[model samples]
Target: MAKETKNFVLRLDAQTMEAIEKWAEDEFRSVNGQILYILCEALKKSKRLPKTKNEPTKSNT
Candidate 1:
């Protein structure tokens, strides 16, 4: 089955938006994709996102 995603509106300052746009371009990703990537990284760092069955653990390979 496909994963479900929730959508919400986000607001940011013009300067911050421009910085994100540049960072996204540098990383060869869309602005939205970059934001999602950053959020996912933060969640992982904080241990808020649990590992899924499909993901390989450090000892698996």
Candidate 2:
């Protein structure tokens, strides 16, 4: 099954939005895609992203 996504309004300063637009253009991604990528990376860095069913759990030695 495909995952469901929620949509909501996001307010951003003009400077921040401009930066994101430039970044997204360089990376060939839409603003929404760029935002999702950033959020996923941050979650992974914080070890807060949930493990998918296909991922194996780590074993402590």
Candidate 3:
């Protein structure tokens, strides 16, 4: 599959940047990937994530 991605500038203080670096290293993900994964997971868990562009979502009765 082709990669789905968008580039956006985000502002973070030094400490937050440091933390993200450490966490990304610990989780074996690049910093950008870690942030994207985290946001995706959060949206999924919150039921705010949509089905894939090609997939239909079933509504609960």
Which candidate leads the pack in lDDT? Answer: 1
Q: Distance from true position, residue 12, model 1, in Å? A: 0.3
Kindly give the stretch of ten consecutive residues in candidate 2 with the minimal lDDT sum: 52-61
Pairing residues by index, what is the TM-score of model 3? Answer: 0.75
* Candidate 2: clashing pairs of residues: none
How many clashes in candidate 3? 0
Candidate 1 per-residue C-alpha lDDT over 1-61 given as tens digits, one digit per residue, 9 for 90 to 100: 9989899999999999999999999999999999999999999999898999997889996
| Runs off by more than 4 Å, candidate 3 | 53-61
lDDT per residue for candidate 2 within 1-61, as digits (tens), equals 9989999999999999999999999999999999999999999899899987776777632
Q: Which stretch of 10 consecutive residues in model 1 shows the poorest summed lDDT?
A: 52-61
Distance (Å) between predicted and true CA of 52, model 1?
A: 0.7
Off by over 4 Å in 1: 56-61
> Each model's TM-score?
0.81, 0.88, 0.75
- In candidate 1, position 55 carries an lDDT of 79
